[model samples]
Target: MMHVLYWSGRAGSLAPLCLLIECGVPHETVQVDTSRHAHKTADYLRDVHPLGTVPALRLPDGQVILESGAMVLHLAELAPSLAPAAGSADRAMFLNWVAYGAGSLYPAYQRVYHTDHIVPDEAARPAAREAAVVALDRCWDVVEAALEAGRPGLFGDRPGAADVYLAMLALWHPAPERLAAACPKVRAMKDAVWALPSMRQALAVHGLETA
Candidate 1:
């Protein structure tokens, strides 16, 4: 069984929770309420995730994994059904897309939604947010093109951990209208991923109906 440190309604927490359900892994959820800034406390930063991020997973062997994408990759290795085999033909693309979503696109959404954290100056937030919107839309376009080329799923005929990561980011990004207009394929992909029973259950836990 894995143990996940989570906070409700946070996008980062969604990946680990959904992966656990998809893998049929028995897990315990330790809620770190961000509403009260519990995640920012020194105890949390030191004892849990050093960067104070939620969705850190404690493995059965006393190893704690940070980064939602890293957790998904590890879980995929454990449960091969969740992703392609490491050396498989599709594995390289899968890995690339996962890293792109986490390292590139996800931060763009962060800049849009958490502008205050990105720039302390209130006056500068507008420009930052506008720039993020452009970057985010471009990111969506890239993913959409990739999905269109790889149809049925992100990598081939079936969804993988990378698609799950994409879905999470697509849902969290602030410009849904822009996303729909710019990345119809990705929007459709997200719909398919969310329709899965595992993802449905995960979203329901946070009272989310759709994304």
Candidate 2:
């Protein structure tokens, strides 16, 4: 069994939680609410994550894994049907898109959601938001181009950890309608993933509606 620290409404935490649900792994969740400053507490920071972030997973062996990307990847490995097997031809491409979601798109979203943290100055917040919007849109453009280059989903027909992660990120976009209109393939991918019974169940667990 795994224990995860997360806040249900947050995008950063959703990816791993969905993965665990899809994998049918038994796990417990510890809610860390930013509104209550639970994540910033000294004990939580010291004992769970030094960076005070959510979506940190404590494995059965007591090793804590930080970052949703790493958590989902690790969970996928535990249930190979959730992802491609190691050394498979699709593995490299799978890893690449997953890394892109974590490394590129997620940070842009953080900037959009927490502009104050990026620039503490009150007057500069708007500028930060504008920059975040631009950055996020650019990230989506890259993703749209990638999907257009080949088949649906990051690794073709199968929905891997990367596809799940990307779909969750898309849910966080400020204008979901605009996102769907601009990124048809990403929208298709999201719908396809959500069509899975496991994904629908996962969304139910999170109090979200199916796509």
Candidate 3:
């Protein structure tokens, strides 16, 4: 059995947890409450994840996999319908957008959430957050355009791991209402992913069911 380390609220673990539910794969969810700094504990760092992050996957063989994006891709392998086949024409596109979400958008949000850490000067922290928000809007524009071109989801017409990944990121936007207004297509895509029963269950677990 696989074990997913997670926490309540909108964390990166939401996507993989949703996929695990969608795939109907047996797994256990272990909450690492960040509010209490459980993730930074010595035991977690030594046994679960050296980086001390949630969304770490403990495979059946006891090896742990970190990084939510990597978990999404790996979980998709267990349920092929969630992603394009390994060498299919859509495979490249799928990988491209997933990387974009993980590499680009994820970091952009981190900049906003951790502006004080990124900007040493107290006076510059707000500016850093504003810049991050701008970058996030630009990222959404790219996704919105792609969705407008009739690609309902990153993996084709149906909501898949990539779609779930993007949706989770979308919720992290500083201004979700403004984001939805500016990127209607992205909103639609998020709605599509949210419509999935498994996704709803996962989101509810994360206390984001109304989001």
Candidate 4:
């Protein structure tokens, strides 16, 4: 069976977990409690994730896949319903938004959550977080416009991995209500994803069922 190394409440793990459930694949979840520094352990770092992070996928063959975006894509391959058909018209748009969520939005949230890592100076950390928030808002603006124009889902009428990925990131916003108010389309997408049984199961495990 495959294994997903997870840390509850960590946003990075949300999309992959949801996809795994959506795919109905045989998988196990191994919690690497950040509060106990389990993710920083040498064994976990060497074997599970070189970066010592949660949401790494240990395939049945023992090949570990890091990066949640990669995990989502890989899992989607196992169950194509989670994504647009490869080379289809919507495929490019699907890939684009998935990359945007993983590359642009994820990093922006990391900047806000780990500002000290970027700005070493204590006095500058707050400013760094503020800047990250602005950048995050801009990223959301792009998503909002896309959602408003696109189908109910990020790429189609069906909620796919890209929609799940975006919803996972949206929940991490520093001020979710403010973001929702500013981007109703984004909110609608999130609400749609949230209603999925697979997503509800994943969210319950991550303690985000009420989110």
| lDDT digits (tens) for residues 175-194 of candidate 2 | 88988998888898887778
TM-score of 4: 0.94
What is the TM-score of each predicted model, taking all chains together? 0.91, 0.88, 0.95, 0.94
- Model 1: per-residue Cα lDDT at residue 80: 86
Cα lDDT of model 1 by residue, 10-90, tens digit: 648787788888888778777778888888899888877788877788887767888888888887877787777778777
Candidate 4 displacement at residue 138 in angstroms? 0.1
Weakest 10 consecutive residues of candidate 3 by summed lDDT: 1-10
Name the weakest run of 10 consecutive residues (lDDT summed) in model 1. 1-10
lDDT score, candidate 1, position 45: 89
The parts of candidate 4 lying over 4 Å away from their true place are 3-5, 149-151
Would you list the clashing residue pairs of candidate 1?
Answer: none
- Measured on C-alpha atoms, candidate 1 has an lDDT of 0.79
Best candidate, TM-score: 3
RMSD of each: 1.9, 2.2, 1.4, 1.6
Higher-lDDT candidate of 1 and 3: 3
- Candidate 3 stretches with Cα past 4 Å from truth are 149-151
